[model samples]
Target chain A: MPVIEVNQLHKRYRDQVAVHDVSFSVEEGEIFGVLGRNGAGKTTTVECIEGLRSPDGGSISVLGLHPARDRAELRRVLGIQLQASELPDKLRVAEAIELYASFYPSPADPRELLERWGLGAKRNTAFGNLSGGQKQRLSIALALVGNPRVAILDELTTGLDPQARRDAWESIEQIRRGGVTVVLVTHFMEEAERLCDRIAVIDAGRVVALDTPAGLVAGLIGGQRLRFRPSIPFEDAVLTQLAEVESVRRSGPHVEVTGGGDLLHAVTSALARHQVVPGDLRLEQATLDDAFVALTGPAAEN
Target chain B: MNETASATRTMARAPQRRAPRPFRALAVAETRLFLRDPVTVLLAIALPSVILAGLGAVPALREPADVFGGIRFVDYFAPSLLAINIAVLGLQNLPTGLATYREKGVLRRLSATPMNPSAVLVVQLVINLVTVAVGTVLMLAVAVYAFDVPAPRHPVGFVLTFLLGTSAVFAIGLVIAAVAPRARIAAGIGTVAFMLTQFFAGVYLPKYLLPEVVVRIGEFVPPGIGAFQGAWTGDGPAPLQLAAMAVIAVVATAVAARFFRWE
Candidate 1:
């Protein structure tokens, strides 16, 4: 059974439809990613599942409990990390952890949790004094202190450095290993590719595509490009005439081939037959970035 | 593997855990934050007595005054300054603090937890109320010890009027916090309200010597109500003044509750 399910969810803010028809389910102990452009209703959809906002025209269930009606019960098992959420500037890190821990009945030990999150040394540090990455780590620790069955993290690593981002990914993997289901809302293609078991790409409040990292990247496989420099001169038609080649272009001494279905083998064999050896050969595999662009159209950036 | 799965299942199926009391955590956190704010501490818990001390040290203010019914001028000024304490905290400090928290998404974040977001508001109200109470105590102590100000003839009446007046001012502050779009705007509105109410409360001029029009208006305003009734005159707020304050308190609190936004 799905741990969290949102079906045909629709939400509007003052006549502006924030989410039109969002539908997906997060299976238990999986890192389900919601990838989208900014203002693409990713946060709004997750907020609905978190019971922060009620959908106008759909039903949501978490552990067989209605989000709106069972908000109190859901809160006990669903941890949330809101985008740009902040604590009081003067609050100490240890105090913050303990205070949030107090809100849960059987909370994890805050001191141990802090140490595990790499924040034990900063326990006495004031929130305002911490760097941006440290603050994000603290926010993550607070979200998990309640021992929630499901954790929803929104824009988890928007402002972190590359190393910090890796640390966060490791922490997320650890959370999943502990049997907590995670619904991660993010726009970073690389983050979704690395951490998500499956990603639902949202654009304009719609789920444009839903697939695993490799599966989504497969959508752009047919358009994969291969480029090489031939040892001997060859006509563009020589490559273009073949069934595997969609189009052929020559820029300087390089011949760029764009197509799918054994194009590399076909090009290499043709080159060998023509007594022309290809040098500086490179085959560019389709990436999640290309697949994301194909799925969501233009102007999608993290 | 089965044992691990069953353990996880049992953990998920167990009864929902909860914090000890509803808003105790929020209240405790907010109280810690309040103690760390130096400006609020000085303004709400220290400034009232300082102002009173300044007024008392003036030799001219120590003279017997017919306007005060043979009492020294400084003795009559004590309660007026106490009103200023409530206005400074309730109008200036409380509104800005709450509005900033709302602007920073603090309240919205709290809503995600099991605790009600309004718990933060309650915490603010409690903290500010305590500050006002402390300031009043210090001001009264200074008035009695340093300035030789007489105790109120109608102590019970003074206490009741003071409580009503504080609630009325805090209600107006809450309305300002609810309506202001940002912390800066809230602080601005609070400052204007504080200054205007201070003027009416006769902070700048003696209530007995004010112009008839000013005194009549002051009769309806906060601390001003206390002043017009004679802070030391021992008489409580007049029936009309008391009724107006109660009305303002109820109406403003209702409006605040209706319009307050978490973010």
Candidate 2:
């Protein structure tokens, strides 16, 4: 059964619809990605699911329990790491961890959690004194302390260094391997592609596309793209003679060849037959970035 | 198989785990934080003591037909200052602290946990009450030993007034904390309210010396006006007035709770 099921979830701030008729289900132990640009209503939708914000319309259930109606029960089994939350400036890291642990009926040992997150060394440091990455790690540690069955993480690596981001990704994968369902909301296409089992692309408060990253790329791009910097300027006759070349387009000095199966070999054979070789030959598989650009019309500046 | 059984045992033991320790932990943490601020500590202790000493030094501050019937100024103002101390902590410190927490997103983070918002509020109140109690005791000690203030004419009346007055002001502070747009606004409101109480409620000045209109206005304001009747003048007003004030406090607390923003 799906650990979290949200159907036709709708929320509005004043007259502006924040989330409009959104729906999705997160199966047990799956890393589900809710990918969207900033202000795409991803956070609002997830917040409603977490019982932090009451939905204006539709129903939400986590582990078959209504999140709003059964908030205490839901909170007990579901952990959340909000994008921007803060602890008191004077509160020490260890104290903050222990305090959050004490809230639950049963919680992971604060020491163990600290050790796991490599935050044990800075346990006595005040929250405000910690670096940005340390604070983010602490937030993640707080979310896991409840040993929740389902964890929701929003903007997991918005402001982390590359190494910290990689570490976080590994930690998330480990969490999923441990049989905990995760709902990851992120704007990073690479992060989503690497971690998510299924990706839901949200745009303007709606899911514009939903599929596996590879599937979405394959389905959206239609065929493979061959990019080459030709040694000699090519004529239409040279391109039309290639057997696998379905279409061709040129911009500046670059040539793009579009076709189906074994298109790369066909292009190479045709180029060799013509005694012409490109200076830079590359076969490009469609990526989620390309798929996002195709579907959303323009890549959102991150 | 052994791991599974041990895990099952742990899960079963989880439900029977001890009650939440966040409140106690937060209280100790908050008290330590409070003490770390030297200015706050000094204000909490010095405000009442200074008032008590200053009032005791001035013998003419007492009126011949004092409301206590024959009570000295020191005897009357001591408990009034005790109420004032509670009011200062509750109305001033608590609201500003809450606003700061909201500004810093501390309360928002806590709300996301299994701990309810009420638990955080309760912890804050507990810390405030403890601090106020200590300040009250110290003030009382100084009043009796150094200042020679008379003992409570009616211990029950004094206790009742202290409890009721603290509740009322704390509720009022909660309202301010909940409704104030920001920390600056809360501080501004708290300062204005404190100054109004000091000037009009006759904390330092005699109420009889004030104009009739001002005295009439003070009749309704808490701590200063209410403390005069409740603590200073034992025969000041009927019991129903105190009851009405308590009701107002309760209503204020309800309204504050209703409008409280955990953000």
Candidate 3:
């Protein structure tokens, strides 16, 4: 059975209609990513799972307990890191950790967690004094302090520098290693691709696609492009003669071949028959970024 | 792509037990935060005694006055200053602190955890009460030692009236905190409420010398009758004043609880 299940969830804030129809289930230990554009109801959906917001229509079960009805029980097993949420300005990092830890039955050692997250030196620092990256790390640390089975992190790496983003990803990988199921809500295609085991692409409050990172890239637009500079000039039509080649273009000394499935082998055999040596051969394929743009289009502008 | 690398790294999930009482931890943290707030400490803890010292320095205030039944002016002002301390802490400090916490997302963050966000509200009230108690003690010490204003003759009555009066004002402050959308709005509402309550408590003028109509209005208010006048008379606690405070406490607490927002 899945650790978390959100089926046909519908939430409306007055007349805004934040979430129309969204459904997905997270298996016991996989990192599930909710990918969407701003205002795509990613946060709203995650909030419902966290028991922070109630759904207008649909059922949500986390660890076999209803999110709203069994909120108190569910809270014992699930941790949450909300987007744009913060601690008191004067609250020290150590104090924040201790206070959160106290709320749970048994929490991880705050000192060890801080050290693992690279925040040990900031134990005595006030929240307002920490840099953005440090603050994000602290927020993540507080989320895991409860030693919960599952954790939902909303926009965890937003506003972080590139290095910090990578560091956070490493911490998340470690958290999963600690046997915690993670539900990550984010818009960054690179982060989702790097961290998510499977991703659900949400656009306009609807699930447009749900698949593994590589599967998503392939399922959306399946193709490959081969770029090369021919050692010697040959008839361009010779390359196009191959049935696998979809399109061929030659710019100056460089030739570009675009096609899908076994196009590389067919073109290479054709090139050898024509007594041509391919120079600077390079293969380019679609990435999640491309898939994301293809799925969300104008709505994905961030 | 790194699925194999992660598969080898999975650690066993351990069954963990619940910790000891956590509310006390939160309460201690709140107390530390409350101590750090210079605005609250200055207005609620230090200013009351400072005002009392200022009053003691004036020769006219030390002279006996017929309006106060031949009691010295400084003696008459003592209990009123203590009432002002409670009023400032409740009508101003409590609401401003709570609203700022809500605006900063502290309460919202707590709600997502195992801890109830209302714990923060309760902790803040507890911390504010401790601060007011300290301020009350300091006022009493200064009045007896420095100004020679006699301590409350009716000790049990004084303590009961003080508790009821503080509850009434704190409940009203909770309502303000619950209704105000932001910290600045809470501050504005608190200030207006504080000013009105202070007026009724006779901060600007002697209560006995006030016009009969104004005195009658003050009699029905908690800060005026239950806190200040009750403290000064040190006589039998008036049943009407105690009933007024009880009604305010019950009704305001209900309103605050009904409307309070974690976000």
- Cα error of candidate 3 at position A77, Å: 1.7
Lowest lDDT 10-mer window, candidate 1 chain A?
A: A215-224
lDDT tens digits, residue span B59-116, model 3:
8999998877789988887776776788788988899989998998999999888889
DockQ of each: 0.44, 0.52, 0.58
Ranking, DockQ, top scorer first: 3, 2, 1
Residue A104, candidate 3: alpha-carbon lDDT: 89
Tens digit per residue, CA lDDT, model 1, B48-81 = 7998898788999999988887878887776677
Tell how far residue A64 is off in model 1, in angstroms: 1.9
Q: What is the C-alpha RMSD of each candidate to the true structure, in Å?
A: 4.4, 4.3, 4.5
Alpha-carbon runs more than 4 Å astray in model 2: A222-224, A229-246, A250-254, A259-279, A299-302, B1-23, B54-80, B204-208, B224-240
- Per-candidate TM-scores read 0.90, 0.87, 0.90
- Model 3 gets an lDDT of 0.85
Stretch of 10 with least lDDT, candidate 2 chain B: B224-233
Give the best candidate by TM-score. 3
